[model samples]
Target: MTVAANGVLPRPSRRRPPVTWGNPLTYGLALAVAAVSIAPVVYVIVGGFRTTPQIVADPAGLPDPWVFDNYARVLTQSDFWGQAFNSAVIALGTTLGVVVLGVCAAFVLARYTFRGREALYTFFTLGLLFPAGAAILPLYLMLRDLNLINSYYAVMLPQIAFALPLTIVILRPFLAAIPRELEDAAAIDGTGRLGFLWLIVLPLSRPALVTVGILAFVASWNAFLLPLLVLGDVSLHTLPLGVQNFSSQYTSDTAGILAFTSLAMLPALLFFTFAEKQIVGGLQGAVKG
Candidate 1:
């Protein structure tokens, strides 16, 4: 055994780059982005605490003598609550309508390969491209014809219609991810199409549904132009319209406006806080599927 002289193979050494704080570029960039994003929220919150005079005197300074009266006023105002209620109703109604219709449409498009399927999908998607502004005049006329102007339905219906396309788009991919074998098995068991969809598809689609619901809620909540044109009645005004009214009524009352702004934003904030994870997960699932 003429073995070679005992020679050991050299092991490759692993090295990691050392971290250093002296390279503050990344930290500085992150700080800049954070400040840019958070500044408006801080301003609005601070403005809510200060009186109009204080805000005007020092636009960026902290409130010297904090006042809770603005919040109190917003809470106590009858219009505030009434408008908030109207907004809630409209947003909830729109979300429900869009999700129901969108899911049904998505199921059809995803599961059934029928004639004109692509055309139907395209037709529904076309709504997404249609600007709310473009349809305002026609919507106004239609609402007038139906005598729904200034009613919650005027705002609610259009919001549902406007949101439906995006909802369908979001849900179609999720629905497509579901195994066809499941539906076939249900069919073999004599389950009707609607039964399978209602029982199996809907349950499996909770994440996507929640994601769409949140999106619809946000869209309906933040809507301005549609409600502005349709909801002429101050009593029926949604939050966006209500905020506009608040601003107009109290243009000089900076604190009051900020208070109302903060209040108006609470629902959206709470909604995102609760459903944000679901929304992200659902989106990821849809993409992966």
Candidate 2:
């Protein structure tokens, strides 16, 4: 028996609760997981500042003198900026296309119950399973036939097509989560189908839309194979292709390659950082719904 604060004997000190081994083990495992996940990013950041010789010599240590010229070279280089612009345009265009088409498709899929609906979804989703590389020849021929090869539109169109299925997959559930009463209420208030979508669905889907937008941006921005095959002009090359050029031009300059790689990754990094909260919130909403 335990004594009470007052002088009476209390219940055996309530036995304090037994500390299990699981708690400490779980904390240790979580810390280990976090460290593993962070190690590569740390390595990349450190390696970006080191010279080729330093990286070849150490491969793992912090840069001794911490040279910043890598960043300076990347920023000052004219090719880098132009390629970055190409990436930006493609990413923006793809995001817009995916959003417009995905939202429309998702609205139909979620709100309607027509025949062959599942088959239609399956057809759209088939694109996701088909590797973009597998479609290269077909895409090239089609774009060439349309006289769009070597043009930004060629890359932009394929990127949008490839990204649409995933965007639709993301948006469908989010659209479904919205209560039907909202749309019915809007309809009762004289809102037409387009008006209902424009005012009701679009506004409520900001988070999901932002999430898909970020995904589309990143995918299109980093697209290598499609653009590489289609875009032949140096002026039209995206960041990934530009980095490949940097590698070819500076084959002996490993430091320069690392620098270019680091520079190429910057836009994606900044975009994810800025949109991380919205992405997380959107995913959580989708999961909870």
Candidate 3:
């Protein structure tokens, strides 16, 4: 400790915590993990701009002669946008449904005491333990019986249901953490429960909502089995389904396949990248609660 000019002892400075680079092992491990995770994505996206032979010859390298026409070709294909639209519709629909319903249900579960509430919440959480694979056959049969086999609703509804479990689980903690005094204060301001939800709760809960929405959107966008089992019409296929079909439709055009994959993957990557803070904050808040 250093003495001040006035003879008062100065406070010792705190040391900075070690960063990944501060420890060689930590830095090396992170680098290795990053390379492992990122290499495949880079190759696929970059490979989209290379000829099949170029990729086959040097799969690890950049395009020998970069090709933009592969993307242009995919863009020109009408089915590309159609599949994208279908994916968008399903993802957006699922996200909206999950967020709205999750918020409401989670609010009720967290704030209100009711009969069978614990039972209902437990049942919902149980859904997380059961994989989608377990319910696919029955889910398929139910949708088939409803004559929804060829419709987007068939895919969207199941996703919304499956998403609700995690959505409710994540949202409950956030909702519970909202000080009851805030609700009381809002009530004195003549806000009804619904108004409180919209004006106070919703705004305050934006982080959790955004996190839930992003998760739901990504899950729905990448969903394969539900769409595959429910949607029989080729035109209604989502991107993942479309990507599977593209393999057969353009087996000879590896560039097109890679380009299609990159395009399909781009949206979720962009979404997560842009809203990373909200997701991280939301998760931390949920965990803390």
Candidate 4:
């Protein structure tokens, strides 16, 4: 070590790990998996642009003469817009309910020391194993008795309930990881539990919240059987149901059916695509916590 004029030795420089381009084999496998997953979606979307005759002639060929009439027709339909509105309402409603309730419950479990708190958290965790399909019969009966059939609440409430388990699981770690010193500081400043949560915790947990919100929105948007069983009226049907109805009504119009299917799935795909980073970040934080 070299000494300075005042007899102080200089500190050694720290070395960082080398950057990696990763394994070519791993990248090749990822590309293969991605192509397998994406091929069908690409086919459906591109198929919408070809005539039924063209599709029949070459199932895997590109559209020689691209067509927009199918998409235009679906867009012009009043029922298409109606179904989109229904989907938006249900998705947004489910997201709101899940976020608000999940955060409050997670906060209590994370911060408060109460009897059976671990048990309670365990119970919610068990909810992850409870598939909606298993509860469909009893759920339908209960909703029918409540006279909630054919309404948005019938769809929204169940989606929120099913989504809550994962939401709380994702968020509790985030909330619990909040430095206890911060809470003490807030208390010294006269901030109560509610104020602390509203003023500090919520802001810190925004990533997890956004992650859960996007998940709920996408799940609600794609749900089909629940809406089918609860909403018998065509007017109340969401986009998934609308796709079913459209396909049935135009069984012979292959291109039209493809167009309608593409449109039906577009919203969820777009939502998920835009929020992909938020989801990855939230889960990483949860795991680290």
lDDT score for residue 235 of model 4:
90
Give the Cα-based TM-score of candidate 1 against the true structure.
0.86
Clash list (residue pairs), candidate 4: none
Ranking of all candidate structures by their lDDT, best first: 4, 3, 1, 2
The positional error of residue 114 in candidate 1, measured at the CA in angstroms, is 2.5
Error of 2 at 161 (Å): 1.4
Best by TM-score: 4
Q: Model 4 residue 104 lDDT?
A: 99
Candidate 2 local lDDT, 1-289, one digit each (tens): 2223442233466766455344454567677889999787767766779888998898778899899988788789648999988888888888899899899998998888899998998898888798888889998999999999888899988888888887888888888889989989988999987788899899999889998888788778888899988899888999999988889988878777887887788778887888889778766754664
Clashes of each: 0, 1, 0, 0
Model 3 poorest 10 in a row by lDDT: 1-10
The reply for model 1, stretches above 4 Å from the true place, is 1-24, 281-289
What lDDT would candidate 2 get against the real structure?
0.83
Every model: Cα RMSD to truth: 8.8, 7.4, 6.2, 8.1
Give the TM-scores of the predictions, in the order they appear.
0.86, 0.81, 0.86, 0.88
Cα lDDT tens digits, model 3, 190-287, are 98887888888999988788988987888888899989888888889888888889978889888889998898889889988998887787677657
Q: Please, what are the lDDT tens digits per residue for candidate 4 over residues 223-273? A: 988999999988999999999988998888899999999988888688778
Candidate 3 CA-lDDT value: 0.85
Predictions in order: lDDT: 0.84, 0.83, 0.85, 0.89
Per residue, candidate 1 scores C-alpha lDDT tens digits across 1-289 of 1323333223346354344443355566678889999789878977898888988888888888999989889999637888888888988999899899899999999998899999999999898799888889988999999999988889888888888887888888889889989999999999998999998999999988988888788878888998888888777888888888899988898889999998888877887888889778766754664
Q: What TM-score does candidate 4 reach?
A: 0.88
